[model samples]
Target: MSVYQGRFEGRCAIVTGGASGLGKAAAARIVAEGGKVVLWDLNADALAAAKAETGATDVVALDVSDQAAVAAAAKASEAALGKVDILICSAGITGATAPVHEYPLDSWKRVVDINLNGLFYCCREVVPLLLANGYGRIVNVASVAGKEGNPNASAYSATKAGVIGLTKSLGKELAEKGVIANALTPATFESPILAQLPKSQVDYMRSKIPMGRLGEISESAAMVCFMASEECSFTTASTFDTSGGRTTF
Candidate 1:
């Protein structure tokens, strides 16, 4: 990938799930463009690896599902970075795949807690910081499954749908402010997260994509960088598609 020397210069970004997958890709992109980034994830080992790989400005190991932890991290971020200009909520999990009737209650709640509530915590804690600075960009990672539900993955689908909805509402609320909110609905991608889904389900998702292949992390990161940049001005509460033709709307 070519370097983007100054697109994000003078900016500080916070990327949840920065230890791996799409979040790591986004963090790497921002750092490549001369931006400072704080990596937040539950895995300390992966966080260390990402810091080594991406040269992120800082790393914090915490579960975003905990509102108190999120608040603390937000405070720490302000102390270290002085201000936050970008937020990428990429931390999530693919909960167990089963029909709604057969889905385990525990699994269902776990998915909602981590995927939906966790994102809310991050946004709630960070948006105020952004408002204080009078400038910010928020990129929430939804999924094509959110737009068009996939059979047998009710919990995962529902939480992702909620993410898209939340982005829209938050964007509208912050419309007049410099901070903007947007969502990205990507199809299946080549990432460790893919291992969580059933083989049959993974194959089924890929087959539905016109491209006939999983998306590359670079593709998602590229679009996210643009959305997290100043060029994304005037486009808030919008859902951007990176579904390889799998998403019609």
Candidate 2:
């Protein structure tokens, strides 16, 4: 029997980027705990694979950056999951690592579009559904890079910073309601997302961690499960540190 077998007995969650990485980890944990999940991703094959692996209730192949697509998916998610009691916004990309002036304009925009704007769109469309239900948990996956800016990753850092800001504002706005919003700042973890960065940049991040090693996927998923639970009642707008002593703030 699962340790969290009954923690989410009747809950349903929407996990963006659910095909892999932190998102997939979170989805797996939720399902293990008895919650239903809807996997959302841009890759149809990944979505199918994730659905098969996790027994997710549904899958939506979507680009969260596209407002219309996000809106449509939100409706579909509601239909599939019945009600989205939890939302884990784990869809993001580490764009090209470059200094501010050296960063490509297109790449910078793309990073902002996916990491920041996509999150905004997902929240924008889903928050109302959550509010109508009168209860919701929102876990936005940020990075330690946002808190302590990395040397050559301007766009990624900026977008994650935006996520933190957005979470704080959303939490305050919904404090009186039954909805809660928060962000998670995690250090480099062993996941597919790590392959997007250069080895030099990856090594640089690992060196910065006081733990002397990269984070594990389970560590992140554990924190996400807690934040997505009713146990996280008093922590809206707060930032959870999963950064292995890398985040001091």
Candidate 3:
């Protein structure tokens, strides 16, 4: 929230799930900070609207869960932005709200496919490009649920945990390559993703937050932009918290 004027100047980024919520918020901020972004999301209509709203350089519509689609998107993104200096993988879903004993098999797979494998695809594709440039930043959006598993939301929690692990491993691999990768672990936040959960589940998450309120988009966006900026020079493979006291470690 402090003065980050032109912090991202001349940078080009690829933001997945850029159609709504925190992803869209981060895109707008990146543009405000003098950077260009190519937005990617599954919804074509939403992608178009977000592109207009965020001043994004271009938009790609494809399901992140599809490996082929993700690879193609990365190529298209590179062509659109000329080069990618940053990648923000924020596409995910909170699948069925059922206990592990009763969870829907298909729903669980869907969540993992998008939240974990999809993100992996994006990182794997873009990392080479980042190494080629000799400098890059990656912010993988995870969740506190990953650290403190949520009951009845095993799939979501598990996938986010996988995201954290992938980011850590990636950070270490690229630490000497000038390409840094980190994960963002936000608590219960006011995101459209919440719509996927039931009210009881939402309230349960809110109660666990010491602040007794959901996180703000601006709050998380600030942390996100910081992690994706040159200011995050010394940190990689670490988890940045924006949980309003929910995560004290």
Candidate 4:
């Protein structure tokens, strides 16, 4: 049973990275609250699992970094859902943990491709569809590291920072177009993505949080739902925080 039943009675959403982690959490909430959702991820098996777990209406397996794929996904989602009301971009990577001098150029490019360019592609393809409907909400998942500049993770930090900038620019452009956009900046959170990093890297991130804890996946999902809600009106081009007191701004 959902506490906020029917908040999304007729809404439809596209949740990128919906196979797991934050994206799956958000998708589950949307479904529980009476919304239709389409899950998109890079893994077909994982996407299938998520679809069954969350009761999402559909799933699309594609890399967000692929522009043409994203374009086709937008069309497919529009066709399947009738109209897209929300876009939650939570698909990203941590890249390799290394000092700037030691960071691999290929790894940096890969991070930028998925974290920044991928988001750009999603927003680019979806915004026009939203504009046609005259209503939409977009929540791009960023990171506190983007603002604080975490040590030895320059690639992840720089690309996440780019996500913030991208959201801000899109929000402003859509201000008068009945669409809203924002970035969610989270600190060290309990996510599968964290597993990609060394334990020491994860520990360093947790140490920076005043609460000395990783944020629960549900906590971040709550914020994503709120930002994706029509109730979140009057706030665009802003960043919402789930940094466990690590970030006050």
Cα lDDT of candidate 3 equals 0.94
Model 1: worst 10 consecutive residues (lDDT sum): 74-83
- Model 3 misplacement above 4 A: 1-3
What digit string (tens of lDDT, one per residue) describes model 4 on residues 51-153? Answer: 9999999999999999999999999998998899999999999999999999999999999999999999999999998898899999999999888889999
Clashes of each: 0, 0, 0, 0
Give the range of the ten consecutive residues with the poorest summed lDDT in model 4: 1-10
Model 1 — TM-score against the truth? 0.98
lDDT scores for all predictions?
0.93, 0.93, 0.94, 0.94
Alpha-carbon error at 223 in model 4, in Å? 0.5
The digit string of per-residue lDDT tens for model 3 on 56-92 reads: 9999999998999889989999999999999999989
Candidate 1: residue 73 lDDT (0-100): 93
Q: Record all residue pairs in model 2 with backbone atoms less than 3 Å apart, i.e. clashing.
A: none
Tens-digit lDDT track for model 1 on 34-76? 9999999999999999998998988999999899999999888
Q: Tell me the TM-score of model 3.
A: 0.98
